[model samples]
Target: MQEPSDVLVLAERHGDVLTLTLNRPDQFNALSEAMLDALQAQFDGCRDDTGLRVVVLAARGRAFCAGHDLKQMRTHEGDADYYRDLFARCGRLMQSIVGCPVPVIARVHGTATAAGCQLVASCDLAVAADTARFAVSGINVGLFCSTPAVALTRNVSLKNAFEMLVTGQFISAAQAVERGLVNHAVPDDQLDQAVSGLVDAIVAKSPLAVRIGKAMVYRQLGMPLPQAYEYAAGVMAENMLTDDVSEGIDAFMQKRPAQFRGK
Candidate 1:
């Protein structure tokens, strides 16, 4: 495993698992322009590297992320273009995580508010500490969490999303899991182990199959039912032609574990 860098901190790797730690603990790992850029670069690197199979997004400190840095925003509030560009960049950063070829898992250990909660919802899977809490509280500060609502609405029911947006009240990790925002809720001490277990399960699969399957799921989810099925069938057909698929099937027939080269 590589050491943590000045930008995005990294740790732990066994084969294809890459754990990315958000490093701004002082501000609860708040999303800043520099942090966004660092995250984008890391996601891009992971996309181009076939050796990487999974990404674990974990943060340092007591909060996963306090969302966008209000101080940073205040510094450019007078400049409309600056504010627009900043938010646009943030959006792109979120999209990068969503569109990465490898599956991404969010390991939340603390409060995840506003855009932070959106980050959890955007991930392919998320496991949160039982002590963790989530909220979309931009409304309390006069700014509506419109951007966060985009992800929150898709992950949960309309009523549930609206309640969080309107009330700006915090919900426990269990509530997050029950509302479909988090995949599981475990004890704080077990968060790392739980994340590792889930990543191991992902990495055990053929990388090419997992990547193609993940991409197809996101693409098809936005289309009509029939069209979605058609798209999925196309993806499956293409995936079946890969060398990994052949090896996988042959290994199954031969009663052995498949050795995939991600071809």
Candidate 2:
């Protein structure tokens, strides 16, 4: 059962971009059941909306997120079924972010540990504050961050992800970029600005092209090299048949900006 809170997550829309901010600052915006449900609901809404071009996952307060609410987890004690259901729900939310048509950019401005770090990894892209730190530190409490490891390994090298999980050590934002965990790390004050830069660039492109490309990128990653190429080639061929692609090529030749209607 979720604890009652009017705004576990705050949603703000500016034109075509939707920003979802975690609001439980006092608790380091920990992913309580309520918070997860709030986030899941928001992503579900985005799935069907063609007008939405981008989603920025941000947080309020000092820490972006500290991970799961240990207090809530503690309440369940040794209930194995409860834990399984919880993790399953969390997994579905992460998958939803990946499957979203519009890109989800993690705007990390503070500490993101354990599942918090997993949230960042699940996004299509991320920009972090230079001072922000990340870790999969559930090992410190004698528990392995198995779920986070799944996302971590996909984003970063196996050795690096294993080290974080085993050692429970923190990595600075710049190091995160080096490890391919985040795209850019800017000064703390410029975090939101960097996120907006990505948002602006994405929203300017053809919505249909972006949607198709995002889905193709993830799907191809799971295929064998030759099969991946074949899949991509088919996707590109179909993409070329769209009016947006035709307009893009015409605009390039005509020396004019493309007026992509997302057709």
Candidate 3:
């Protein structure tokens, strides 16, 4: 497909993989109105397209994302409507990432702070380079990252999340992984390889299974133990009826690799 304006660069394919690159490297890929709009549009398109399987969120900068552009926020100071709308748009963007039918992966290479860390947590999976660092430092600037707290709280423990928010200290990639913030921490030079490995693992599965499985996992996460089991049972029953499952079962019985059409 044709690229969109270079402001929100999206490289997509039919085989269920899409890569979105935040293009504002000069400001450490900070979120801009144009970038947010482009991301919203791209994700909206992905929602409609059944062929899409996964999304890899990356950036073309030394830093993955520094968070909201303070300059932009300053420009809209005293305009309550503008601030409200801007944050609302950003929240929707993050929600889209979470609610996406396909799994979303955040590839973090450098500093991810405040809302940037929120973006990483919002994704289904995250792979960070050894050089990467994360912080929810909004409190240091007198603004609490109330919005980012939503995703952060869900991903890490209450104590861990509170520590990051309250202290605003930068945590290493290894520390992040241990705290359940990142799925994998790799050498900076091998960041690409590590991400590719993750993508390969994801794409190797039946697309429909992966998509539905991801959704079900999130759906049941907040449920009571018994209710979660009930929900999972229903999903499992439905999943067993799909053609991909049938093929997978047959392939296993026959001791051969299965070729899934993502049906």
Best model number under lDDT:
2
Residue-level lDDT tens digits of model 3 in 60-179: 878999999999899887999998898899899999988899999999998999989999999999999988999999999998888899999999999999999998999999999999
In candidate 2, clashing pairs total 0
Alpha carbon deviation, residue 239, candidate 3 (Å) = 0.5
> Order the candidates by TM-score, highest first — what do you get?
2, 3, 1
Cα lDDT tens digits for candidate 2, 138-235: 99999999999999999999999999999999999999999999999999888778888889899889999999999999999999999999999999
How high is each candidate's TM-score?
0.93, 0.97, 0.95
Cα distance off (Å), candidate 2, residue 11: 0.6
Candidate 3 weakest lDDT stretch, 10 residues:
1-10
What is candidate 1's lDDT per residue for 100-137, written digit by digit as tens? 99899999988999989988988899999999999999
Q: What's the lDDT of the predicted structure labeled candidate 3?
A: 0.90
Worst 10 residues of 2 by lDDT: 1-10
Query: How much is the lDDT of residue 36 in candidate 2?
Result: 92
Model 2: residue 70 alpha-carbon error in angstroms: 0.6
TM-score for candidate 3: 0.95
